[model samples]
Target chain A: MIPVLRAAVNTLVHVPDLVRYGSKPFREGSRPGSFLADLKARLRTFEDAAAYPPHQAFIGNLRPESLADIPSPWYGHPLPGASHQGPFGEILGQGPFYSMLEKADQFGLVSLDAGWTPPANGASAAAKGLMSAGARRGTEKEIRRRIGSGEALALEHEGALIGCIRRDHEEDESLAARVLLENLAAKASGAHALRLLLEKARLPAEEVDYILSCSEEAIGDRYNRGGGNLAKAIGEMAGCPNAAGTDIKAFCAAPVYALVHAAALVQAGVVRNAVVVGGGSLAKLGMKSHRHIEKRMPVLEDVLGGVAFWVGPDDGESPRLNLEMAGRHPSGRPSTPQGMMEALVCEPLARAGRKLREIDKYAVELHNPEVTLPAGAGDVPLTNYRTLAALAVIRGEIGREEIPAFIRDHGMPGFAPTQGHIPAGVPYLGHALAAMRAGTMKSAMVVAKGSLFLGRMTQQADGASIVVES
Target chain B: MDLDNQATIKQLVDAHGAENLVVVLGMSGEGVRIAAETLTTGDPSWAGPLAGVSLGLPVYHILEERVRTRLPAEIYAEKVQLMEMVLDVAQIEDALAGLRKTQAKRS
Candidate 1:
């Protein structure tokens, strides 16, 4: 059964504006040995990131808020423009995200009112049902602490404390408010993307049978650290009023894995449509910026990237996910780089009776090179493409002399950010669909890999792939 | 799965004889202490396969002596002690090599 690409949406949040206030180090009593502390030091060393050319260019690739309008860069150069807004979603500034958090949080709801305030701003109930009860006025001391400590972004009406987030949790180490705040921002963005996708596909939210959150944030208190139903929560928030939800985790490969699972479900006739959604990670906010700053480059790791896509029954008009051709990095496979590509790329194509050259495009880790190169990781996509070409020659599919030309034909530059789980190769689906629908391309291969050792589970690498055909 | 040290110990003693070779699982606190005592030096560095066993799926093979194996609770206190026991994976491998050599010689 053909797995249809019904809809796709990508969203990003520019966190530089919100970093000081929302990020951990700038918080009142920030802890040591945290990512935030490292980030804080990095920020102090590199005052501004917007001033860098590569940073601006990085922003240029993200102009179309809608993945539909965005040109898939795998064909040629990336889409042009520095604008961060699109019809489906935009790179949200922190102020609105904080308001979104207030709206999403029931315990510490924020209320902003324009009542008698000049150019009004305050955290007021963005949604009434979630914050049905009128917000209690915060004490001057409490308001001062929230703003001063960077625990909450202050809501001011003519410089008056109109509203702020409540410190509902007792411990600083495990603040439910911050976790919920970050999660709600994702939910709001995902909800927005899902709405746009439903509209794009002309399908109602209720029609979606399942929702899978492939995001990497673990939201829970100390007692139930990783206990989660974030899938259900994100879906419910996205207005999937009747869908069941669950989270899929394999680190960077989650989104694609979710797509594979959705295809299987649709093919099995268990569900007509499923949405795989992932929100960006706040923890990964300034993760690699230390290297970026030290090298005198823009901290291109500024945006919180997110995407949601629909896996539905095939219609002749859409590109189909070749589920049977999907690859799995099985147990006992060697964890070497050569072993990895053999497991994820070559072996899968062999099983599907296809050749490596048959794939017009390969979307591996499309991390924007400007971000990685400065940090000394090199161009990730180019590396993968070169490896693939080398492997093709070794496998006797092509001669060693064809390696360079093979790379030129198959590889597209990587345009994704360092959002740990966001760029594990689904970004190309939008472009692949457009190209296939336009009859410009025949097939695109999406490859994703994950490090299983981070969990202390195993040292072996993990990978899975799915081919989409026109 | 819970580790049954008593059965494993009994099996090891039956196969290689107590003086020749001893097996320690480090399942319980006592088991870990006894295993550490047996080593008398060095540390139970859980570098490779042993690390997988501690935090991930357990790998088991039926020895010349048959004994069922069980793992400890996911977050038991004894786990750290067990992981820290003196049975370094390489050393354990050497013991297996010794057994292989012994079998070849006998043959």
Candidate 2:
């Protein structure tokens, strides 16, 4: 048994963020255009997102009224205490995130608070720098002055620039401040959630034996592209220097992959404690918001989402990750939605000799509906749960008539933001643990799925699952 | 988008190299058709790069069947490339062997 001691989720949005970043100017040539005007005109206001039900849910501030009235196509209103600090994690706006990147690495941060200190060795960056996406165009001296300036410019005509992060050599564009800031934000956010888990477990930060960072950040200089050490870098920032770590990438399935690895390590007595953590994605911010704003719905997808948990030696107390019976979609399996559920749900239950009703809950891609619904992706979590129920009926584990009751009893409304990797099977963990402890629930199936073709590596859609018992 | 199933199957088979399939399956054309039929029954929603393997078994099974093909089996099985055809000597020899056996029995 591997216990998930604590879980945390955080949200952040830079309004002139992904939308501005993905515009033409950032890609090749620097010809500024009217894109910024269009963005500013229709961008989601902080108040609008702050009052959105899904945002409140991501930060763990969702009201019972909102949770109970789950099936309504409309989100009635924001919870009363939506502004309160989340029980799970904090919801930070971009201004604070800019400062967080600075605070994440004070030494790398320019003392001016807003700007970055330029690399002392101008020759290296000049020689080695290839203009990567978001690469800063400046001389070493110009960069140095920008760093030293008290009011260092954090924004240009379009996007926000959170000071530069440096590499071993001042000259590598691969370690450009832009890339470094992205990496640091991921690291800081992962550490933020890690620290929350540490507090929850009452365990010393240093006591963690290993850290597995499963975030979507791919940090690189021009030469390596995505040559990475993200997990180790995050471990350093999260105050777990003693813990050895590495990254595990499977797109949205990464956290579950990390969980399996962590559980294996703990269960095998290789480590006493291991933590799996992931930060939100900036690339995904405003990803689905154009549809929302167009439909007159709040751009509920405005916030980034994150989650972290400790996989420790089970105490015979906490909710248990049942490693013996895990479900996996073989690389040969079909990649349809029904195929995913069959491989990840029914097969695992078959292996365990348990019926569908025996499992109390199913947590599969919990992307909040407020965001996905308007975007035509539909209610992802509800769809996944209902798919599980449908599969159960097909397997004759339950009658078709029982499907409605099964959903009402076992399915949780989607609350996680569609932060690509974070939304997979992790959001309900906080609630699942509480339910298990309260004796209202016995076990759950945590399923994580991914589109493998995104990497162009394989045609197969990837998935994995594990039974978590009370 | 090109739903002409037979042409699509031929294109896929050619792209994937049926020389290996001819050697592996014994019944070359039948195996090709089976593989193609499995591929073209693709999910209408997913017309992306994964169209072939998305709904089918893992690419591994298509490459390596339930029976393992060993290293030494390729030593004598050679093929001539005449643009569209990979004429394998092994497949040719197998057919000749069957023809000879039947002819000798008739005689």
Candidate 3:
């Protein structure tokens, strides 16, 4: 019999940093009166003004209790731990081989192996010269200190050590997405790592009944017209002849959503075995690292994107997909964006009849704090999770008094500067599965949210939650 | 000029009084109605006059159908353009003068 979800693993590699050696170089011709410059200036003003003393002054200017009432998961949690020094070198030293083995052993990942291509010449030169030079010379100490103190930055996985690729530098979104996916596919050589994991589990390629890929991309696309096409590219490379990829566009919640979909397919007798995989993209990494790069932040380049998995049987031992509930709300609603998120995410989970306190761990929006904080939003995923928890209490799923303790017990500060897909949803699956298997927890939930406004047409916000049971 | 929906090409030419009138035909819709009125009335404001007439089906039918299918209640106007074809630029200028005469009479 095939095991349900035998194992899951996540690996975050550090990328090299970009080095800028001039007075903050604004885009040429983007001087006063230019729309681009004006927008940048406005954003800079808001970011700077937010950091002023007398937090109450800014707070007073807004509606009373506006900031206070908004619940956040990281609200009183200690700042996240600092990155281990020698970022990329430290990651290389740790190696995917060792980390995967250790994690697999802990999670009962039956057959497992890991590998990565070394940084390319350009990447190595930039890493050594730009990244190390900037750090040693203290050129961006304030930014680095913030990063050291957990400020988020954009990150992209180029050829080697994940680095901060500037979003503004990209001329075309489609081309940028294609390059990012191609770079990731080239590095892993597609299907080799998957095959190794399958072999360790004693499963053959053809026996693999279905494949659920969770990298971030729009569904039903023809070419590079939509989001990145990582699934189609990897599926072709893996040669799973029966493979048909479905996009789980739920941002970070993707991996878990993929896991849930695979489990459901297996339970329905559709496929005997399935593989859930996602590769990191440079664009997502770059967006997260942008703030740090602009300020010459320390550890500005350690965000690396990596692929991971959960391979198991249609029916066997391990956590099973018990999708107790799922929810979504369209963007046309006149309600506030926060209200939209609650209706789509928090309400559905509550209706599933699971108390917030009953859930041993709630994994939602695990975006790297360092990557998002410098932009002034704080950890998005953590904030969403906390809000859900608070809503649960308000709804009587848990006592209002227990909300604080529940959040404190169940939350994680941040994971890595991986893209929305990396830390947002799937990172905790491995740990959650392990805890379930060990009977430490009966169930866990993974939540992911995304903005559809990026398309410029849809004001819609969407998210998904998956329940896994041991 | 109230041009009937089923008006013929000859009738349109006789009413407009152009020696070699161009009759651009299209499926019955906003474009067709506008073209018929402009041909009958010979008003430059409503529709430009034609020298050597041409008839073609409506270009906006597909777009109209699509919009109708998706948002039936939404009101949308069809964009249409008419041009006169003459033997030369000089004849084109003469057509414009004839068009002005008809327009002036209507005003």
Candidate 4:
């Protein structure tokens, strides 16, 4: 049998306070004459979490199917049900997130106060979740000494002291406290998803033979800017003692790229179970805060998203990953939207002996409209669906008159955060798995595109797609 | 914006001058702000040839009321109807309005 996607896990780390630390915002706000105070004043408090609709949809507390009926612009219209735990995984809060940072730390760099304790609500249970996830806390210490000596950065929530992350090197700016916080956040969130993957797959940690990290963080010294093995570090944190790992980078397309690679490894019998995971991006938190503030809405990008997929040999029942139907965009192809749709969608369907109308769903760039619309980014997923609909019209699969209905039926609203790789195609896997199990959908395609030009390396766009069938 | 695009815009301005060119952008949201700023105040990103060269050109997003009202209804319906339906037009207009106001103050 060919490789199949056995299980998938999605997690969100609520780090509202950490929004100020996002790479773009932090870098700009730290400069002279920046409006740092105004930004801080606009950030939403944790008490507002219960009323946030997107937050509810993220943790599986609210079904994605229900979101279609919730009316457009889901910000002010808060959904009733709210929970930290979802069917896929939990939305770990700030206190537990801090605990995770310490848990990911190997060199005693993160120091939580001996008397410090997790909050008494959902986060209290998360402390136990961390332990079950195989996160270990070494010798706790009073972090005050290092903080007083200016060798550590205090981790604060709602203006209260929580813990601190110690600087790795006295003078090396590369090991500065801020950089460590970003790195630790990625590892912790990735570990959280890995743990969920093991639980969802009903496999022991040791059974995971290989780990692939497609996270967007660059974890290395200045001498070797992007050199990395974050995958191994995340596996260690998640207690995958036998899992050797490596990192893959393709910008937003990395997750799909990694998924294809995982399928190959499992099909080739190189690894019994290959896990592809991407951690939450701290730098992406509050990515659209300026627009959210202007619109008088909560910063919807406050949560950091993490996802993991367990790929193994086909179990006949699970959704088979049709590698033969995989699509790739060649460098010579035009990077226009229509060109992309042709390369990633049309060509793949043609080769797979399928029709455009046969695809039950298409998960494209899933950036949440709530976070994007206020900033004039428009509805990203809706635009992609429209493009697909137009392509269908041109192919005579659907008439121009059927475009609106076709788009509405084939695609759901964008619900993933704007954390680059986090929103790129894979977020719909958990929902697709459930739909396939219920027989509501027989076939779907996961597609993603990357802006390679963002790195200033090349103007070429990167993209890949794979068909999933029940 | 790329330097080549900015260089082309610069040549166009030099040939026809800034006053005659009312830059109209079909971009949505923050994209309108970036392109408008590039025309009116100069390239804010500074990666292009328009850096520090204030063209002070009047700019409008195709979704804005000013430009939408001017276009023939049938042509507008055919060309931009779908994009307008999906974009947050009011927010995009407001962003351009604010930028234009800021540029006016600077001039």
Best by lDDT: 4
Q: Which residue segments of model 4 deviate by more than 4 Å? A: A32-34, A45-47, A120-150, A170-173, B1-8, B11-26, B29-107
| Candidate 1 CAPRI grade | incorrect
* Model 3 regions more than 4 Å off: A1-3, A17-203, A217-224, A227-229, A236-246, A250-253, A288-290, A293-296, A311-316, A330-352, B1-107
**Considering TM-score, where higher is better, how would the candidates rank from best to worst?**
4, 2, 1, 3
Encode model 2's per-residue lDDT on B1-107: one tens digit a residue.
23454345446666785443332322232233343334434434344333544233222221222332342444222211110121223443444345336445755
Candidate 3's residue-wise lDDT over A59-110, tens digit each? 1122111333333322222223322211111122112321222222211211
Worst 10 residues of 3 chain A by lDDT: A129-138
From the highest lDDT down, the ranking of the candidates is 4, 1, 2, 3
Return the top candidate by DockQ: 4
lDDT of 1 by residue, A255-341 (tens): 889999998999998888888988777766655665655665444576677778899888778888888888888888876566788
Least well predicted 10-residue stretch by lDDT in candidate 2 chain A: A122-131
Give each model's whole-structure lDDT.
Answer: 0.60, 0.60, 0.43, 0.80
Better of 2 and 3 by lDDT: 2
Docking class of 3: incorrect
Question: For residues A1-470, could you state the per-residue lDDT of candidate 2 as single tens digits?
Answer: 45444433443443344344431313422445433444445665455556566666665666322565754544456555456245655555444444445456644342222233322221111111211122333344554566565223233312434333344346675565545555666766666566656665566778888888889878666688677667777666666767888888889998888888888888888888888888767666666655655676544555556677788886767777787767888877778677777788888888888888888778888777767766656567766766777667656778767867888777777777777888897766766666677898788788999888988888888988887787
**lDDT (C-alpha) at residue A158 in model 2:** 28
Model 1 chain A: weakest 10-residue lDDT segment is A120-129
lDDT per residue (tens digit) for residues A137-234 in model 4: 32335566778889987777776666788888887777788888888889899988888878767878888999999998888876866788899999
lDDT of 1 by residue, B19-43 (tens): 6653434232222332332232212
